[model samples]
Target: MTAHLSRRTLLGIAGAGAGAYLLSACGSDEPSTPDGPQTINWWHIQNTEPMLPVWAAIAKEYETAHPNVKVVIQPLENEAFKAKLTTATQAGSPPDLFQSWGGGVLKQQVDAGLVKDITADVQPWIGSLLPASVQPFTIDGKIYGVPFDVGMVGFWYNKDLFVKAGVTATPTTWAELLTTVSTIKGKGIVPMALAGKEKWPGHFYWAYLAMRIGGLGALQQAAKDNNFDTPDFIAAGQRLKELVDLQPFQKGFLGAEYGSPDGQAATMGNGGAALELMGQWAPSVQASSSTSKKGLGDKLGYFAFPAVDGGKGTVAEAFGGGNGFVVGKDAPASTTDFLKVLLDAANQRKSAATGAVLPTVKDAADAIKDPNSKVVAASLASATGFQLFLDQAYPPAVGQQVNDSVAELIAGSKTPEQIVKDITKVAKSQ
Candidate 1:
């Protein structure tokens, strides 16, 4: 199903004023000159097929166009890159350009004067990209980064499994979803595929539940108040607990990874489970990780997260974030220009065609050939509200607490109330 977001609601949930303090603290050192020769150091997490070569090709083309400019590419896995970037940024020396998800973490880097404010530099070509994609990178009224990909989370289900389980249609309400889960379980099929060991994938369930129960505003308010001890949040955990009690995930799911052969993606792709709550990239990961390396292909389907019975938030609201690149404080003046090349309409379309990225450039949307991708893109375009991933939206400590507590709740080690209390304590500390 498609969701629509009003302009006002979009701006509010985007957290426009949350990073105001970043501006004052982010003072750049000497700017790199555009003259003579310069090398741009870029670090990104798309270290696998399609994107890995695509990015490398783009950089090579840029170097050929401008021999004086050399682009150094250092591609790393997601978690490793995050750890390395943290250590580097803490030392006040980051890559000239690097991967950025654009939320509290980006704000922290801005506050530490480790990133550049590229508002005016990107203004000329920024209009070509979707506003929602740019919103994440925009701090206060200034843009600090450029988005190359944008998407939202939803259910990627195996249609054949659902059919075998006697589920005629996708679940639209919380009750229907639970019933569907039970039905699937009754048929001796795993109802869901989750990466419990990774924590982030598990957090998606609780986050979407909270959004449905308390509305998008509830999360923003909770962050502002530094408190998650509200009825909505508590109810979110209770609802998730209800599902967890069903024991619908794959065997040993708690130890499952996200993209490994025995992980969430492979489980879903190989039809070991009926569905997965994941982002637009789910299909590609599934295909790459599956034993056949072909996944379920046309048998896969997509649907928005189910709504709650009397929830304040509509199914129209979305929860997800995109990938982007932020300029390091000392990046050459041409760095923004190079970024523009990466996001140009043709390149964006190429990325979309690979079926690995949901392009951020408005005109490139039509290039999305994958049916599942089209569904997600349509949902994102029509979303009534948008929430960045919880792990990126709030302070690191608070976000980690949310993940940790949710994992505990799933493991049956913590009650709903206890999870809320644990998260609240960390939020307050932040």
Candidate 2:
């Protein structure tokens, strides 16, 4: 989706409250549980196979246990759900429970008084989750959301392809990465599979480059100061440009979708590309999108993003985010209770078993059967610094600018200096 559309949607919700529409059928003004049965309106983005059935089964179990509670579910595609939720929140009534990425968007909801403060309600079991998993949901030392899945972004490569390219070890630094790309290209294999049409995937390169060059504090400082025109950010664009100059991506990559048959994940899963920089869900997406409907089984391997020599960031620092659920301010008290059941170790294990999510519950880690997922989980656990996806870390306008500018840079239409200036302009305006 374009930045204009996203910003407009968020703006609508930001201005909502006084003259917004209310859900008359749901009795908006009544106490959460007054006279009769209580219904929980839930909206989630797991509308596809594996997760769809898993979540539905869980909801059924919850309803069976609580005869007085009625759980209403509305499964939506990611962008569709976001747009609908934006309208609902603007109408002054959000779902009782909804998917949350736990970043600036959640912060906006919190500031608007749309989300509930779940700190107290989850205090007892919150400690059972990984600290890193909960970090994003904590604002001003108070929690507003609960994470069920947590992970980081890294290179998912085909071991056989690496061998074909004569690459003996995974690159650990920027210089080595370039060399690896060149070697892979020499072998006549596409060095990388990128979903350029989906701007977020391309932004991963610039974002990770910035993290490697300026460190995690640089991102926070830029957001705090509303400026991104720093030397470090400029250098990030320059380094990313260096990679683009090599023309390492698959042919017609600029129009590629993320999970489409000919897109990034499928290209990698089909062994048509050497690697792809993606999150923990990469393997699952690859498998689902490929012709065989089964990605390279044991041949797929994982590695952390390479460090940039002389840069402030270490290989230990990670860039990524995960999925969570937030409660609406007017949600019934039973909402928290149901959330507790959803995130219980056993249920989390069930979710993890799908080989789709990296569980947040500490004890549920053992349920991760996929080797690649285990690698990602281990990296996240040991990460010294964490950064959420840029698009999720900033307001819609600023975040979208980052994506747009990076896409321009990759297309050879914008200079590093121009890209940072453009991003800074949007940041300041926001």
lDDT of 2 by residue, 96-138 (tens): 9998877778778989999998776777677778777777777
lDDT of 1 by residue, 225-298 (tens): 88899999999999999999999899999998887789998998888999999877788778878999999999
Residue 420, model 1, lDDT: 92
Looking at candidate 2, the ten consecutive residues that score lowest on lDDT are: 12-21
Which number leads on lDDT? 1
Residue 65, model 1: Cα distance from true site in angstroms: 3.7
How many clashing residue pairs appear in each of the predictions shown? Answer: 7, 0
